[model samples]
Target chain A: MLESYIEQLQRVETLGELNDQVVALRDTLDVEHVVYHSVNSTGEQYAALTYSPEWVQRYLDEDYTRIDPVVQACYRRFHPIDWKRLDWTNKNVRNFHGEAIDSGIGNQGFSVPIRGPSGQFALFTVSGNASDDKWASYTQEHVRDLLLVSHFVNQKALELERGTDQVQTVSLSPRETDALTMLAMSYNRAQAADSLSISEHTLRVYIESARFKLTAMNTTHAVARALSQGLLII
Target chain B: MLRYIYADDLHRFPRLARSMFVDRAKQFHDRLRWDVTLRDDGTERDDYDDANPLYVIWEDTTGGHGGSMRFLPTTGDTMVNDHFLHLTDGVEIKSPFIWECTRFCLAPGAPAQVSAALMLGGMELGLNNHLSHSVGVFDARMVRIYARLGWGPTILGTAGQGRDATSVGLWAFEPELRPRLLSRAGITDEMSRHWYDRSFGALTPTAKPALSA
Candidate 1:
């Protein structure tokens, strides 16, 4: 599962592709469903999935998305979550869960939250019939991979939607510029620091310098400013 | 350090790519080339310069960096090139797979290293896959740069656009000569980490290895 899934998810470059992977995983595990849900910096919702026809139809026909507990809870939280952990005490939620399960969505599920700048938020989730123990193991082993996949998928989607135009709002140094560029291209700070052959502390210094120059409030804003100004190209 | 887009660098990459592309656009405009910029959302682009590879030049031999360009592959996938490059009359020309270089500019008092990096990277991307050849119009002052990099002449319809005689010079040729310097230097399909303090992420799977004393 790990090896094959890793290979398939490696080249994923859009939110659409990431959703495809989730759907694939659900089928591979012979689970009830799989879903990758994302909200961009603009709060636009994008999703790819393999839900039962009944639930999908119901969602569209009745607009259950507006009141779905999964959607509401996932948005409020900041971590990978389980469906069971959400506020399912509501009668409507219980009824929806019953309907979803009846339609073969299974009772056990897991979700991981993703964060980005400009209010970009996303959730990757899988659901299936399984013992609590089994679900726990599955998530622990694959959490890191899922987190990475979600971001790459989201990145491509953003690119497709954002296109390739930039504004100049900041001035960064070559090294600082390089560090931020690597990070912008999706390398975590640690990976970027390693690529630059400098200590993480040094990387932090460069990032701070860039952030100040851009007048950005945080690391993400600095990246945004640098990108807008054409100081770096991914 | 240098980096290439791959699968590992996904986490936090979308924002990174968006930033980098934006910065690249500004660099182009700053250099007196074409003014190509990204939209505010920072996701999609559709300007005159979209048909290019978005290159940054760095000269390691002299510790300098400046200039940027977008390299659009004519060889790898004509569809991709046309998607960005407005081939209005349609790309119905005889030449099918040709790369288009666009939105190029350099900073004032730029370093030789920046040009070197751009040249190497552009050539590498050209040779990395199938490309009929490369094409672009340049200011007369930069004509020497293109010639030094080995791009010139050929069989094609004349494209004398705009009154600037230099801008009217349209040319195309195969990348058969010397774009493979990168693969030769042992930088193949492995993941790369391009260091830019700008805000952006990775294209491939980027794993930061633990440094041991």
Candidate 2:
């Protein structure tokens, strides 16, 4: 069963074993491809995929990463996105799309954008060549499984690369915590500032400082981390 | 009658869910030419559909698909966070009380009243679950419809060039529109009460007043 694959992934000791699990996951989900690519905080990279070797080579030869809308779009997101919703405008992107489709890469794709400790960003993608209707049902049917599998993969990879004891607890200043709490409670900058009796500019400073301390991508991310870590209470 | 279908329960309603896909194919692919994939069986589905989304489905008396809307926790993967953040001026709306709604579909030949009912049911589902905001990417036409129904949502992004310009935004659960929209759609009080009464038969029914006006 697919659940067993996740259990195997947890005990995987080497990259090879981890990759085999990913392929097994792809098969279990009945999708054409499954890919996980990560760029760690230190800019070190690792990728596992089911793409053809020639396509991978061509992608590298043309440096498609620079023009990949999926990558660009996912970098700014904290959610999983459907490929159809992505903007594929411009001649180069269209050509790349055509090439990818021709290379037997599935016509339908979905990617989940993940963020981990120390500003790490990673993506887990599932793709297939089903009709829009079938793919919709397929994605709807397996999204939960995919999300669970993805986080498991990312956690295992992180453990392998940087052992498990590296957890760092982030602490924010009193003012920073106050600012984050207000933001988490759905207060706008001006409203939060007014409640704190600080100028908007001062509130901005507090938020920025908290963001730095937490290494969050944005204020929302900062608020999320603070709430999750019990650094800020509602 | 509207029913809630969580991811775990979806498998038990395969026929019902597949009907929604078929209806979506007709609406998005054949009618709107939205470049979506259509299965040989004439159903339409996408990757986001797999993410254990909460589904609010309005079914006809004959058990056919009527209208449906999908909900995802904003803390997880959502269309607004992934592709439409520009609508929020680059701000991410991440809150446990916020959910993203997408893939709203109404089967062709459904009555006009189905639209208002779908909106009311979707928002009521959010309110009942303690969700504050329901956000998603929507075309400009929906802006007019929402405004007319007194459910004016905040526009997060500006509409861009082209005939099919789309934007993202959120609809808060306040201003309770169930009664107002139902009346506007010419639905009688008896019909309205029937929906609420039937919903109780579904899983985890909330208080009727929360879904009522």
- What's the number of clashes in each of the models? 78, 18
The sequence of per-residue lDDT tens digits that candidate 1 reaches over residues A11-108 is 46555666677677765555577777777756677878888667789878977767776776556333345565556556676666667767777767
Off by over 4 Å in 1: A1-22, A27-31, A164-234, B1-213
Pick the TM-score winner. Answer: 2
Q: Give all TM-scores, in the order shown.
A: 0.37, 0.48
Cα lDDT tens digits for candidate 1, B78-128: 322234223211222112123455545554555544454455555544443
Candidate 1 at A105: error in angstroms?
1.5
Candidate 1 clashes: the total is 78
* Tens-digit lDDT track of model 2 for A126-164: 988877777777877766566656766876787778754
DockQ, per model, reads 0.01, 0.02
Supply candidate 2's per-residue lDDT for A84. Answer: 67
| Regions of candidate 2 where Cα sits further than 4 Å from its true position | A1-234, B158-163, B185-213
Question: Who wins the DockQ comparison?
Answer: 2
